[model samples]
Target chain A: MPIHDVNVMILDNDGVLRREGKQLPGVVELYAQLEKRGISNVLLSNNSRVTSDGLVRQMKQFGVKDFCKDQAMTSAEAAASWIRHNPSADRLEDMRVFAVGEEGVFRSLQELGIALANDQWDGQQWSGLPTDVVVGFNTKMDYATTMAPAWNAIHRGSRWIHTNGDVSYRNAAGAMLPANGAQLAYLSTTGKEPAAVVGKPNREMAESALRRMNVTQDQARIAVVGDNLTEDMGLADNLRSAGWNAEGWMVLTGVTTAEDCDDPSVDRVFQDIRQITRALLSR
Target chain B: MPIHDVNVMILDNDGVLRREGKQLPGVVELYAQLEKRGISNVLLSNNSRVTSDGLVRQMKQFGVKDFCKDQAMTSAEAAASWIRHNPSADRLEDMRVFAVGEEGVFRSLQELGIALANDQWDGQQWSGLPTDVVVGFNTKMDYATTMAPAWNAIHRGSRWIHTNGDVSYRNAAGAMLPANGAQLAYLSTTGKEPAAVVGKPNREMAESALRRMNVTQDQARIAVVGDNLTEDMGLADNLRSAGWNAEGWMVLTGVTTAEDCDDPSVDRVFQDIRQITRALLSR
Candidate 1:
């Protein structure tokens, strides 16, 4: 699909618009051009710590002032959205989630009217076992306090849901640290794999974005632009497989370097989002 | 090999002799029969928290008062022993280990004259990176304090050594909890598998026992008795493959029930260690 024919755009936050908490070049112009061309755009973030409102605020810091909550979707929020639409969900309020994550997971589930089962230990066992287990990234996770109870709940038949599948991420000091996927990998050693991973490369997150934008796959031409080849570009592949006209555009501002842009998942490669903006606005 | 011809015995502590911290039936007689028959015996434990001295104390409580540190081999101790005998080791005093485990791992490595690197963060990075990273089971392991530094160290080319690979273990309350294998699984998601897993079903621990017994594989007939199939019986199979006259004897007192005992790994099955004692003593 051509950039001019893209009626909807899914932009990855970390590398596409900003890197290391600083806005990259052309983020402002990119949003301005997208709005002028009447294209619905969503900022998709795999960082499960941030809510949609938090994402909007972060985008505002990145010179994306026009980005609103409706244009933002965090993995935590996508997990919550997926839960709300689960076929087993008879009453939204009746589902209790044992969240093994930070604030975004709790807040997103709370916003969806899903009750949270207490994750704290009572010295003997969990305060309460939950019906569902929602895992996200949390640096403070301990075995006795968080993982044990979550393991017990999952073995006892809790519906396991993962916000993302990123096994490692770069920290502030450029060191690779264990992420949510590591925790998921830990729990799934002898247990079940997560029922769904509502992050990039998984269709659930993109489906949530589609639902929020009020567009069906057949009715829209989608473009996924980001720096991560497996995450952003792989998402475009998933969308195209699901009957959407989606193209993946890779940028070199974050993880992917110029030498690493030969992946078939990427439809095209750009030096930065500035090049992407120029390409989209040329016609 | 027949029971009477066995000159060396490897007993798994968990199911063969005790369950949930209490000694099982015929433990005293089992030791007495082995002593009378002049059989060399070593109590092998996968628990990484206990030192050899602690294991001796544990066995004494289980009605075997003669059990000593030399007759016990902990996975933690085996890991330390393996490190001491590593082919790359030139100066034993110069090796610094970043240990992600409980007291046994620390004490074992320290006893072997291996220096410990500080795993604590200085609000910026690890206090010091290490040449080797040894992971064991720690219910208190948190990402920011333990796993993140460990992940960074491993990615930075630290020699990764795992104490054991039991992913889940039955806690005091009989509920399964995350164990060292789960930690190993977590770290190994996008990283290299440990350079060695110094636990059951691996030849390193058995070789350590053989070294301690001062017997060559061809010079002795060995029998490994345990309740778990993969760890204990599989160890017998491993030793056999390594040219030892070894046989796996399954006892129905631990993780394996009678219904689960039809595997080809076992040369014989007993109701418990009591039956083995009776059979060996009768002939």
Candidate 2:
């Protein structure tokens, strides 16, 4: 079915607009075209390694002048907002978060008033320090290093949380290898799962993005466009399944391909956002 | 890339072939066809839940008729052989084995003439009573259950041995979930891994299966087929990575699918053994 839509488009940042830290061929041109038509578009992405401020700055380096930091929303900021709103949750200050993660995760906890501790071990004698929340998203972690805190936490009734359940990451070598989330799973000693995950495919981030856009599910008339089924297309599919006025739109550039477009979960497929924007304009 | 010459086939009995006492589709039919092809196919599975004889009998109900007692070797049997063959290892006839598994595992020890004790309250309580090796697989397992004999054995410097490191089982809903291997990993809580693990993906199982076939690696051609990339493909890829003559084959009916075929480790893709056998014959 043709998506008869207006007003909102959720654009993926990495592949649709940028490639290898640089803007792609049609990114600037497409954005200018969208701006000329006065269509509402926001760069909604799952990457948490960088803050939205950092993303906006990087996008500016590519001759894109129209976009600003407020327009770019990342999963980390949404995670902080999620924690803030969930009042019955484990108090951020009281909980000891064992963060085996990146700078963005650190910044997220700081915003939530959640205290975090990274590798103090650094060859020090290992101690049974209680980690109240064992957050998974660490790149430089090993079995013992990751387990030391989780072992303390689960036994102590501390919660476990994963950043996102992304199983693999792309490298300079062009190999899609096991990501930190899967590695965290291997080191989980107590068979406990993350108390909460605040990333793509999770409703927290999507709901936060929609709220920030100042549009209700019925009034927004939104379309989610991305590459992966589980993370991207599945997000919209899940929203639709849950009775949201949203539909999954997929692209073939990254994690999911043109082949996965055939899956019934996906509402529409596009070669790129430029084509999608044009199609939406006609609709 | 197209593959050539499938001389040997290894099968996973659980989930991939038979799941929770029920045989999956085309299992017996595939078995009869492979048996007619004269392929050196062995069921190299990781189901320590039952003994090899019991498993063979279960397979019989599913229409498998060629399995003999000797041919249906369990990891326990391999562990027994390893102990008997090692000069530094405990002598089978004179040894005391503390078992943490079912009747089949204990029966193997009893039939092999190893001493058995009803160890309770830490094998240490029965310490002076004679304990040689502590064997772990799966019983109606509990913390108190393992702690007693396990602690006693660990304290006495009694050797530790485990069957396979399979972390989970498939649910009735077809979800691949975690299993007892996570508990065995906790035996490190008592300090030390089993002296050896015996089944698929383990070099010992590969070596033993190859030894029983009486063929050198160069002379032996092998194709390993399974549904799980982590377990089945892991078995094949691990063998090949260790320089064994094996090609990692994938079947969609079990765990992985053609959708995730972009993964580099999958060497051959087949719907089932029937198609693979037909292709082999034609080739």
lDDT of 2 by residue, A1-283 (tens): 3465556667777666765455666667667766776656677666667777777887777677867876777766766566556532355455455665556767876867876555533322224343445354554443334444444445445555566666554444342334544434544645666667777787667777777767677666667777778777767776777667777778766666787678877888888767775775573
DockQ of 2: 0.02
Q: What is the DockQ of candidate 1?
A: 0.72
Native-to-model Cα distance after best TM-score fit, residue B108 in candidate 2, in Å: 26
Q: TM-score of each model's B chain?
A: 0.96, 0.84
CAPRI class of candidate 2: incorrect
Give each prediction's DockQ, rounded to 2 decimals. 0.72, 0.02
Model 2: how far residue B79 lies from native, Å:
12
* Model 2 bad stretches (over 4 Å): A1-4, A20-22, A87-91, A119-131, A134-136, A187-189, A280-283, B1-283
Tell me the TM-score of model 1: 0.96
Residue A240 shift from truth in candidate 2, angstroms: 1.6
